[model samples]
Target: MASTDMRDGLKCSICLSTSTDPVMLRCGHNFCRVCIDRVLDTQDESGVYSCPDCREQFQERPALMRNLALRKIMENFRHTKPHQKVIFCTYCVDSPVPAVRSCLHCEASLCEKHLRAHSKSPEHVLSDPSTSMEKRKCSVHKKILEYYCTEDAACICVSCSLAGEHQGHRVEMLDKVSEKKKEKLRNIFQKLTTKREKTKEKVRSLEERWRKAQETAAKEAERVTALCTDIRRRVDDLEKKVLSEISRQEKEESQSLSALIHQLEIKKDELSRKMRQIEELCNMTDPLTVLQEPDTGDLCDPEEEEGDKDTRGHVKPLHDGDDLDVAVISETLSTLCDVITGIRRGIYVAGSSEILMDVNTAANNVHVADNLKTAIWTRKNENRPETTKRFMCNQVMSRRGFTSGRHYWDVEGSRSGEWMVGMCYSRIDKRGRQSYIGYNHKSWSLWRYNNQYSVIHDSEVIQLPDKISSDRVRIHLDYEAGQLSFYELCDPIRHLHTFTSTFTEPLYAAIYVYESCATIFEDWLCNWP
Candidate 1:
């Protein structure tokens, strides 16, 4: 059987019972595995995890170290023997006297009679009968622990705070420390309650968005399917029309060739008849008869009639298949492509308001004007005061960021050196090469340099065709769909490039200027002229 003192030693502070699946923290305190896990879970949102006993904060969740010795001792305790858990008066050496209270200062348990006879001084603090009186006293000084050392995050006696290892450390009475801890816990509780409500609202919003997305996707799919069906039907009709034209040409050419063959056959028959007549005449016995044959101008005519010659010359040849492919099929396909492009352009409506630049993030050489819609690069630095939010490079970000929905903005640039227009996360770097728009993973941009256009993201560059170069460019962003597209603003907007990526943060409009000026247009679509 285990003694009362041994039982107390093996107890868990959380359960006030023998530890089950005992685990030790780095601070040397032991708790049941289940109990500590619950405590840590509650601290997750607080951003500061701490030990339950000492309140020592940890930068991250602490690892649970199993106390194998304690586990074995508990197992042995369960198997050894069963006995009543009762404490006896320390002064009763003759007969068994049950302890009613324990004096932490004296480190002794007492019966009712003995407790009444004991000192009533405050130093002789009495608590419910506890076998582990040593736990409430300082080990080094053998004095009752009455204060909490803020520096050490441990309980200490007055002597320890004054002259012992914890000398000169800030300390507070245990009761006052407990009250402060309760107040902090109450604040955390309030914050948690608010966060819970907000999370619920977020859940509802997300559900609505999910349903809306599904409906939109279904409608779009149906429309696309219908469009494809119509395109196929139109193409089939064109095929039939082209084939019918080819068949008509073939039939006409065949009739002309057949008529010419018939004329040749008739000529052969006529020649045969004339030959027989000549043979019969040669066989004639009298020369007078042969001479009597009238001297005709011609025996058989070899030339075709005027009408027949005209008919032969007018006969048309078969049409070339290549011509059908080029004239009919090519035009049809071109028309289809135009229709599709028009649909693509019409699907997204631009309702984005005027975008304004954030002057706070502008570099020393960059200037914002025209109500924060224009950015110009000055050759000379303005020597502006330094701030962490200010960019050290020739870059500036917009004041507002886009978190959802589609947005577009048009920018007109000067035909000068280099410049860029794009979107970036608000957390983009403010200094060094990484801060350059289009140079880091946090940003994506369309860059114009040396009369060449290109798109860049995460140091990856894609050169666009020179034909897309225009004074004005449009940047379209579908935040929810994770699509960013660039277009050359012309009579018919030409698509330049598209970047697809999953975004985890809000996107802000960003610009980089070098010996150039960029002006963002208010009412981008209306200002097309």
Candidate 2:
């Protein structure tokens, strides 16, 4: 029972057993080095390592100090007495006598029955009975390593100090050196833990920024959707108002025609009555009746038809009429313009450069303008031989390639037809059907067909409802930041879309026109003549 109790006292708190490579924390707690390392890893994000027992936080990873005293005590601890109730006493020669105590000096265990008869010599130190004893001896010197050489950072036996490698090294008893190292480690741990906390703060900040950006993008999309709905409603109202005026004018014209027809029918009936009476009287049989008729129903007077006389092939009322007044039509158009111009948003950057078309890179049917700023698609054109730099389809690139700094330029594109504006590396595919802007990996673009706008890259299409204005489109590039954002330059620049990626090559301004045309030019902060 005494031997079992002895083994329990030396058990490590972490592993609940004897510690392998035991070390001490600044908090004076002992554990296996591997166990403490695992705990430190768990708190690596915060950089605030703490003791499991006292929860004393450290600013840095604390260096572990070898607990030589604890190691020494465990070396003599019994390995065999862990499971069995008792073992035969080393002092006994034969028979099964249970061991109670181990003599550290004599290296033998005595049973309680035998312990009572054992000598009471002070030199014969007693401990719990154990079987493992060879580990205490050093492998090199075949002696116990009781001293620690501070300079060599190693434990050494007495023989090492006399003549071996540690002969002149500064050394102390391992128990004494271990205590000093533990205190020094405590100071180092306190200072280093704070640095890791700063890193954690940075990571947290970046995550928050990303989350807020997502929310902002969602809100912007909703605003654009609502704006488009309102515009559609306004346009419909304008259309209905114009059609209603035309309908009112048509009613006025139709009513006058109906009145003229009624008058003509009445006159016809009066003449027919008169003719029947005259014809019967001419027979002489009713001569008296003809004379008594008193010339009644003499063709309805012409004055009655004089009213609205100009109704004879005349329509001056419908032409230059108030219903078709140009002033009202102009005002309606002005209002429509105001509604659209009011919605343009965002700021335009000042940096810009004039971009010129590269005729050599243009498709064979695409006509390059004299100014080198515009390209028109035509069916009749001089055929050009296929080349590596020229496009297979109706596409062209700017002469200047930007590899650094900020660049902002404007391009006027088709308002009603299909067209594309974007950036691409000079080495983009020149022959494949997917070589067109927005369809390949080397290009990013905003494409429009009628009013529907789409952002495309790597063959993936993201449709946008807001009609991208073709009056003036702005492409902003930040080379160092690896960003390309597109905008519609109106009253307030409206953001269309943005592309972000690490650019590895110089980029050229590319324009693809189909059944349309576009012109690119530099906007030098409104200094253009």
Q: How many clashes (backbone N, Cα, C below 3 Å) per candidate?
A: 0, 5
* RMSD value for candidate 2: 20.0
TM-score of the candidate numbered 2?
0.36
Give a tens-digit lDDT track for model 2, residues 1-529: 7767866766677788878778999999888889888888888988888988788988888889999988887786744445655666886787878788876556678888878887788656566677754444456777666788889898887889878899999989977998898879887876666766877888898787688668756865786688788778878987787667666656875676677678768967877786776666677666566677565544444445444246673433312335345565566567777665444322222334457888889999789998898988878764877789999889999898988876778888867568889999998998777899989899999887867778999999999868654477788887866788888776577788888788999999999888898887656454221
Worst lDDT 10-window in candidate 1: 316-325
**lDDT score, candidate 1, position 312:** 50
**Model 2 regions more than 4 Å off:** 1-353, 527-529
Question: What is residue 408's positional error in candidate 1, in angstroms?
Answer: 8.8
lDDT tens digits, residue span 1-529, model 1: 3378889988888789889999988998999999999988988988788887898989999999999988998899879877657999999989989999999888899998898899988899988888988889888998999999999899999999999999989999999999999999999999999999999999998897788679768976997797777667766876776667667666766776688678768978987887888888889999999989977344644453344344556534323233233464455446666555544444444444547898989999998885898999998887878998899999899998888877888888889878999999988999999888888999999999878799999988999876544788989888877889998887677888888789889999999999899988764435331
TM-scores for every candidate against the unseen true structure: 0.42, 0.36
